[model samples]
Target: MARVLHNCPAPAKLNLFLHVTGRRADGYHLLQTAFQLIDRSDSLDFDTRDDGVILRTTAVAGVEHDSDLIVRAARLLQQATGSNNGANIAVRKNLPMGGGLGGGSSDAATTLLALNYLWQTGLSRSQLMALGLQLGADVPFFLFGHNAFAEGVGEQLMRIDTPDHWFVVIEPGVSIPTAAIFASSELTRNSKPVKMLDFSGAYIRNGRNDLQAVATKLFPAVAEAIDWLGQHGTARMTGSGACVFCAFETRDEAEAVLASVPKKWRAWIARALDEHPLSHLQ
Candidate 1:
């Protein structure tokens, strides 16, 4: 029988705040943000196979199998270890794509972590993280295992304690491409950077997403969602987003607001998580 790792979770993350501090010469914008884990997630099941063939048994709409991050991460791990083993990865996706929830990156990180253990490749957490970075910037954070303050195109992570507040998230029913927002001429790229000490408090409204303006301007639905949610609290966009969220002090407060959210949009409430669900894997 093949060895299997089932129900491996890849939780969604909310960027408590995202600021474009500057632009690197390579065109990757410098960012400072706090990543907060939430209950919303994508889960995976890995079935080990003897042949050296990495495959995604589940298909995501509009995403090619060869282009899926899950497959790429698995293949990368194989190449790095020079291992002949392979696996069939089945994803149970619950998070929205292009909502800035880090779904794909999280899935990729989970693949790297899970396969390393299942295949008995014996890679360290730091080694896995280094390989994850080649997949995407947010991949390393998911592997980092805690809420963090990130910098340098979002690869620099310092564990930060986040408030246990509940968040109400609204998906505006549109896909906002991350590249479009970053490449926009109107996007702000020069917000003055702040020290980590300034954000150690992990308050709900510590800062703002510089990408929000460009995203909202390009997509009116996002602006409408933010405007509606802002009526309840300090509503803001997470990462380069199509989803907007507001943090509340308690579950009751978050649920109450969630009740009043317009029916035209998809919305839900999730409590903040201090660490990743897969933290124990390492």
Candidate 2:
């Protein structure tokens, strides 16, 4: 029988608040943020092959199959485990690219996790997470599988419980390149380092995104989205964002606001998730 895992989900994330706290000599900015999984996701399906040939069976516009993170992830896992097996991976991409929602990173994490199980490679979760980091900083957090307080280039993580809040997310109709934002001289890389307790306390729902200022300034559509959404609640840009979101206490509260958002921008509502959907994969 051909082994197959179908409809596996790769969920999106929201950075409740992101702070650039420092810089490394290597040009990576140190960070502090909360990672919240949401119901929104990109889905993947895998079918094993005997020929040891890995391939993506679907097309993602503007992304070459060989260069896609999904393909890179599968090949990386095969190398690490010395597994003489490969699979045809298909991705149903729902999340927007470069939206600061961790779409690509989450997709890569799912690939590592699903292939690990399908290939019967018994790697511990921590080992998988370490491997995930080589792909991207945010990749490990998806594999961490919990709402987390993240620091140090967004890789260091510790689980934290988050309230089940409803969120209204708006797409600002522009794809903001992450590298351009970080390279801006206007970006402040000196936010004071904060402890987990600080995130737990006064800023639990009140924290700010240090990158928001630079992002908004660079992308007016983002600023317009944030300004309009702010009327509903504590609206903020999630990452180095082109999407802005605000949290509400109830789904109704979120929906009501969603209804009133200008039709020009695509918007939707999602509930907060404390754990990744694929967390249980060994």
Candidate 3:
């Protein structure tokens, strides 16, 4: 009999703040950032198939069938567990790609966790997270199952408590490639590192993203969005992004700001989530 899990939510993450401390010799940038889980999500449905053929049955525009993270994650787990089991995967994409919301990584993490259960693979959470790392740097953080402070190319995670808040996310209508942002000579890579003990909820608004300068220069819409949102609160870029966000004390406050956004842009009012929606599932 086939097993099914329906309406699983792969929640997006906001980089409350991102700092580049240095670049490794291998060209990977070392980062320090806090990942905030949000209610906004990409919903997924998975059905196990006894035929042992992993496939993404739904269409995601601009994404190739084999190139989809959901497909890649399923295949990786299939190989890891030596399971012939397969799945019919459906991704209902709500989050924008390259918006720095970690949509794809969250989807990939959900795939591994869901497939492990459906396939009856006895891999531990740690094991699943390790496999997720091979897929993307941000994947393991989702598997970590909580708001986290991340470092070491975004894989090293320490779960943290964040005050519940609402966010006004302004999508700049441009896709800023992370590779180009990181490769930019103008990007700062010498931010002094700070420890978790140094983090405080009171200072949330004081945090900054070091990549913002370069990103703004490359994608002017991002800069414009940031400037507009700043009128409501402290606006900053999330990850290497075209989407800029500002935190608000309440949902209504966030929504009010969202309402004032220019008609040309897209915006959302999302509440911060303390834990991943799938935390209990795993």
Q: How many clashing pairs does model 1 include?
A: 0
**For candidate 1, what is the lDDT?**
0.90
Give the clashing pairs for model 3: none
lDDT of 2 at 38: 97
Assess each prediction's global lDDT (C-alpha) against the native.
0.90, 0.91, 0.90
Q: TM-score per candidate, in order?
A: 0.97, 0.98, 0.98
Which pairs of residues have clashing backbones in candidate 1? none
Model 3 collision count: 0
Runs in model 3 deviating more than 4 A are none
Candidate 1: Cα lDDT at 276? 86
Q: Residues 159-225, candidate 3, lDDT per residue (tens digit)?
A: 8899889998988999888999999999889998887788776435677999999999888999999
CA deviation > 4 Å runs, candidate 1: 202-204
Question: Compared with the true structure, what per-residue lDDT tens digits does model 1 show for residues 1-282?
Answer: 578999999999999888888988888889988899998899999999999899899889989999999999999999999999999999998999999999999999999889998899999988998999999999999999999999998889999887788999999999988999988999878888878776656443667888999999999999999999999888999889999999888999998999999999999999889888878874
